[model samples]
Every structure is written in structure tokens, then in C-alpha cells.
Target chain A: MRPLDTAYMWDLVPVIASYVPLTLFMAIVAMAAALTLGSALAIVRVLRVPVLDRIVAVFISFFRGTPLLVQLFLFYFGLPQVVPAMTGIDGVTAAIIGLTLHFSAYMAESIRGAILGVDRSQWEAAQSIGMTQGQLLRRIILPQAARTAAPTLMNYFIDMIKSTSLAFTLGVTEMMGAAQKEAAGSFLYLEAFLVVALFYWVIVETLSVGQRRLESSLGKAVAR
Target chain B: MSCQIEITGLVKRFGDNTVLNGIDLCLEPGERVAIIGPSGTGKSTILRCLNWLDKPDQGTIRMGDVTVDAARATKAQILALRRRTGFVFQNYALFANKTARGNITEGLTTVRGWSAEKAQAKADDILTQIGLADRGDSFPAAMSGGQQQRVGIGRAMALDADLMLFDEPTSALDPEWVGEVLDLIRRIADGRQTMLIVTHEMQFAREIADRVVFMEGGRIVEQGPPAQIFGNPQDDRTRAFLRRVG
Candidate 1:
């Protein structure tokens, strides 16, 4: 309603920027956790391991089907209520667990699709060389799957960095939480939000360039 | 040090369709056998089954001291079968991510547990043998189909396999490139490499194989020395197949 505070927005940049590392930490930890858990889930689904496969299927479906915010609230607030022992769990840990599970469900399918996208001949060729199931996956299949998954995985990571803002709901003072507190005091909500948005825009653009370089490098052998 | 292969009553079925049915084959040490047949007659399936790529529905396979029963071949037994034999694929399934040298050294370092230096030396020797020493670092995508298959041969060569199974190795090659690959196989044959080849290249088969096997409808119709099968003709089906291909 009032004139936009261009000068104040510039002032708030450092205040918001100071929290960048916290946001990055949450995203990196969650992405790393998700990638590992997601790959495991993918291999389980691919191998179709008996009871374990069905359990993973339900986990993936539940996490993917539910909203991430609801999951975070349920984990951080509702979890401790039901199980008093879990009340000791902190906000950042809860936020990370939520993000990891939520993103891993999505990542499981993409990783699974990439793993299956690898040619059947690769399996035969690896097996023909007397590679064990572990060796075959480690040396042949996963390397190729990593290439196929790099772009999409990077996409998930970038989305994850943006999504870390939701950590504020659980009382984690990440970049978005910092900005919200700043805005609450100043009543310059639009300016503070815009400053935080610019920070995210910069981070995502830098990562997008990185993603392109990664895709190209990973694609070197596959380039035809 | 070629090993003998005794495959008895080998059978394979995909769903309701039978691909390999009651195939019993025996190979003397270092004996090269070529399997020639129509497209869907299970020629490739036999080679794949021997490699344990396709689990046979029924039979027993004995090579060297290791034996595998189709009904219940353990993981270790199947791996043992594969370790003893090398396979050359129709489409040159060279690992796309690996260079020519890397593909050859892969089995050496991983399965055989050789030192990297030793593996590299073996890979280099194979590259020279395959006449692709300069192209050893090239990826499969960079090489021609013939070159890729040669590297495929080199990968098998690195294994020092007792039996080499060629599954239409040159079938996917360009017409111009087929000769070079067949010539390479002939050179391997000249060394008394125990090979079982399934091929459409009748002329190459006759030239390289000690015995030519004719297969039809998931069974071996006739098998004999190249001269007897190709020249003297035993069964109506073999003759018909030879005639049609010719």
C-alpha cells in the first residue's frame, strides 16, 4: 500500500544473507540423506525384494502423497505428543528428516526410472564378466544411472534449497525465519520477503549453471 | 588349456513359448563349434544359457569341474560358469561408460583381482592383439561397430576364458565392417580357442568352425564337420536352411 522501501530492502540483504549457510546446511544434509535413502529404495524396488519391497512401496507412497508441511508438523509437533521420549528431538533435525523423507520419495522413482533406463545388455555384459550383483551395480549400472539421474537429482536439490524455508514453521531460524522475524519487527513484510527471494534466486541460478556443467561432464562418454 | 563342455538336456521357456528344448551338446577340448539356424530357432538362447545369462528351465551344464543344474543353479555356481566362459554379443555390448582399455581391464581388476598395473598390461596387450592400441582410450560410442566388437573380443580375451561364446558377434556390424571382425575371429580360431559361435555368416562359420551345427525349432537338426553339413547335407531342414540363406 505504501511506497516500496528500496533502501530498506538493500539494508535487509545482509540480515537475510547471514542465514544462507543454515539454509544451505539443511538442504545439503537433506539432499545427501535423500540421495542415499532414495538409491536404496530404488534398488529394493528394482530387485523387488519380498516383504521389504512392499514396505518401501508404502513409505514412498505415503511420503509422496502427503504434503511436506503436514509431514514436518506431524513429525516435529505431533510426533513428540504421541511418543514423549521423542520430545527431545530438535527443530532442525525434524525439518531435515521431513525434507529427506519427502524428497526421497520423489527421488526414489526418478532414480528407479534411471536405473531401469540403463540397457539390459549392460547387465548381461557385467554378469558375463563374473561380476557379483554388488560389483555389477557398483561398477556398471550405478555409474550409468548416476549420469541419467544427475540433472533430475540436481533439480531436486535446488527445489530442496527453496523448500528449506519451511523449516521456519518448526521454529528453525533459517534464512526465511530470519526474514520473517525482521519483517515482523519492521512491518516492511514485502521488502524483507523480496530480499530473501533475491537471495534464493541467486543461489538457484548459480546452481543451475552448475547443473548444466554437471550434466555435460557426466554425459561425456554418452555423447554420440 | 581349453576346457570341455557337456550340456545335457538343456531347456528354456519364455512364458508359454519354448526357446531351447532338450538340447544336449558336447565339446572336445579346444573344439570350435558354430551354430547356424533361423532367427527364432533358439541359436542365441543356447549360448546365453551356457553363459547363464538366461536361466535355462531344465538341464545340467558341466564345464571343467563346475556343474550347474538348470532347476536350481546357485548364484555361486552361475558366477562360476560365467567366470569360465567369455561372451561376445551381437550388438557389441561394450560398457558404454568405459574406454576400450577399461572394458578389457574390468574383469581383470574386479573379478580376477589383479593389480591395476597388471590389468593395464593385459589390457594393453589385448589392445595390440585386437589392433586397436591407439583406440584403447576411446569410448564405445566413439568406435565403429567392428572396433567395438573387437574390444568385446579383447574383453573376453582378457579373461583367458576356457570357452568363448560368440552370439552373432558380427551380425550387428555394417557390411563393410563384417569382414574385419570375421577375420579377427578366424585368428582367434587359429589359436585353437574353444569357441561356440551362433552366426548367420555361413561362409565364415564354415571357414572357422571345426564342426557346424544346424538348429531349428529349438532343437539341433544336424551337426557335423563343415564339409559334411554344408557339402553333404544330412537333414531336409538343414539343407533348406542352407539353401534359403544362400
Candidate 2:
């Protein structure tokens, strides 16, 4: 009502843009690490390897059931007390670790479902054709599973980007953290929060568009 | 090229019921054998057992020089035997995510260690032979049921095995489409690639089989040349099955 206050909003743009790379860095690293870890866990679970499956199941369930913020807090605040080596790890590393552990659990479930969705006859056919267990997975099973799980994995990446905002609580001065600092200094909470929200919206929309393209191309191989 | 298969004392049980009590079959080189029987007579189970997809509780399968003990063979020897005996499932079972080309080339390139270019060339040749050459780039779902089934045949051909096994290859196709698939299979048999087929298409088996075997309750009740097995049955079960399936 007081003339829109366009000047303050325009001035905060560059300051927020400076933190863009940090936010992206966290998201990309977390996504890569999560995919690798999650795929391994998914393979272990799907094979139903004896005692190890139960351990991985418990680990995935625990990470998936809890809030990402609580995970970040635990890694950043609580972990250092329990493990001494974690004391020297900075806030950024802590944030990455927290994001990876949180998203990997969700991705594991997606991967497991995709692997199982491939028809049972495929496995029998592969075995009948003399494929070793490793060969069956590498040549036949994983490629098909990857196609089915791509859309779900992309969804996790989008969530991971949004979840990076929680890193501010861990003392990492990412985009949201930078905004919070500026807001406190200038007493402009509404303006700073609005600008940060716009940045997140832009990133999420861009990712969704890219994800659609990937799904379409992969869908060609899968047919239906 | 030596093509001989000897299955002895084959026994398979699922829980309390025995699907295959004891099966012993012997075939000469380049034998085109057709196994005909009614449903639940374990015709399909014989093909599955021959490939070791379902292991027999006791017995030995000797294809060429390799011997597979259904009850006691190690995993490595079992795989070796399977590699030489190609199988085509009734459902086709083409890898859904792979193109017809990819489906044909996987075994050639992966297990046999052929280069990708060579594998692609082989796939192209086989697709042409199977009459699905134009559908190579297409996915399984994009093609009709007949085309997909043809690709299934190409998949087995690419393996270059001494013996091929078909378990009701045309049973899943629509009535009109069944002929196209059967025609392709008949052509393959004409080439004398050595095949064991389990089929409900009585006319097809009559035309292509060198030896016809009528199985009932996991045992071969009657077997001879098509003329004797199809025209004259020595067992009542075979006679009744022919009346019903006819």
C-alpha cells in the first residue's frame, strides 16, 4: 500500500544472485551422490541378499520417515558430538551429507519398484539364455529399470533442490541464508523472503521442464 | 555339426505334486521334434526342464558333449548347457525397454563377446530372415504381436545355438496373426536348425515335425513319425487328447 517499494527489491537482486552458485553446487553434488548410493542400495534390496538387506531396509526407512530439516540438524549439530572426525566438517559438507542421505532413501524405493515392474518372464528368459546373475543385471535388467525409474528420480532431484533451502539452518549461507541475514540487518523480512521464494520457483520450474524432455525420450525405448 | 539331445530320468516336483515324473527322450542330429499334448499334460514343462529353467529333481540332460545334472550340476555347467540350447517362450518375452534390434543383439554382444558393430550386423541379418527387417528400430510395443514374436525368433537365431526350443510360440497371438508366426517358424524348421517345439497348432506340427511325441501326465504315452502318431495313436489318452484339441 506504501508505493510498492520496488527500489529495495531491485537492490537485493544481485546479493541473492551471488548465492545462486552455492545453492546449485549443493543440489548437484547431493543429487549425484544420492543416485549412486541409492542405486547400490536398491540393487542390494532387490537381490534380497541375506542379512545385508535387512540392514539397508532399516537405514532407508529411518532416513525416509524423518524430516530433512531434522536430518540436517542431526548431521550438523548432533553428529560432531558422537563422532570426532565429523567435528572438522564444515556446514556445506554437512548440508550435502544430510541431503544425500535423505533423498537416497526415497530414490531407492523408486528404483526397487522399477526393477520389479519389469515382467517376471524377462528374468526367466535371461536365465534360460545362460546369462550369469551379474550379466542378467547389467545387460538386461538395469537398462530397463533405469528407463522406468528416470521420471521418479527426477522428481527426487526437484525435491532435493527445494530441500537445499533447509541448509540455512546448518549455518550454510546459501541463497535463503543470505536472504535471512540481509532481512535481519535491514528489517525487511517480507521483501527478502519474497525474493528468495522467486529464485526457488525459477529453479524448480526449469528442472521440471528438463525432466519432461528426459521422460519423453526414455519413453520411446520403453514404448508404453 | 553334431546335434543330439538325450534327457534321462528327468523328474520335477512342485511341492507335493510331480509335474514331470520321469522323462527320457533321445533325438538324432538335426531332429525336428514336436511335442503335442493337452493342457496340464506337462508339455511346456519338458521344454522348460530341457533348458534348465525349471530343474528336474533327478536326472541328466546331455546336449552335445555338455551334461547337466538337474539334481546336482553346478551353476557354471548349467549355464554352459543353456548357452547351447536356445529357448523361445510362449509369451515372446522380448525385453520391453530394448528395441527389436537391441533385443536381438544382447546375447550376441554380451555373452558371446561380439563387438557392437558385428552384433548389429548380425541382428540386421536375422531380422531380414525373420521378415521384420524394417521393424528393427521400433520398440516391442510399437510393433504388432506377430512382429514382436518374429523378433523373439530372431533373438534365438542370433544365439547360433545347435538346438532351439519353442514353447507354444503362437498360442498368445490373435487367430489371424497366428499363421504369420507359424509360417516363420516353419521356415526355420525347413532350414533344419534342429528344434523342439510344443505347440497346439495340430496342423502346424503335422506339417513340420519329423517326430511327434504325445505326452500325458509328464510321460510320453506315444511317439513316432507324424504319420503314426497323428494318424494312429496307441494310447487312449493320446486318442482322447487329439479328439478334444482337434
Instruction: Kindly list the per-residue Cα lDDT of model 1 for residues A1-224, writing each as its tens digit.
Output: 68999999989988888899999999999999999999999999998999999999999999999999999999999989989888998999999999999999999999999999988898899999999988989898898898888888999999999999999999999899999999999999999998999999999999999888877776664744
Could you tell me every candidate's TM-score relative to the true structure? 0.97, 0.93
Residue lDDT tens for model 2, A14-111: 99999999999999999999999998899999999999899999999999899999888899999899999999989899999999999999999999
Q: Write the per-residue lDDT of candidate 2 for residues B45-65, one digit (tens) a residue.
A: 888988888878888999888
Q: Score the docking of each candidate (DockQ).
A: 0.77, 0.64
Error of 1 at B130 (Å): 0.8
TM-score of chain A of 2: 0.95
- Model 2 CA deviation exceeding 4 Å by range: A1-4, A219-222, B1-3
Worst 10 residues of 1 chain B by lDDT: B1-10
Candidate 1 regions with alpha-carbon error over 4 angstroms: B1-3
Candidate 1 chain A: 10-residue stretch with minimal lDDT: A215-224
Model 2 vs truth, CA RMSD? 2.2
Each prediction's whole-model lDDT (CA): 0.92, 0.89
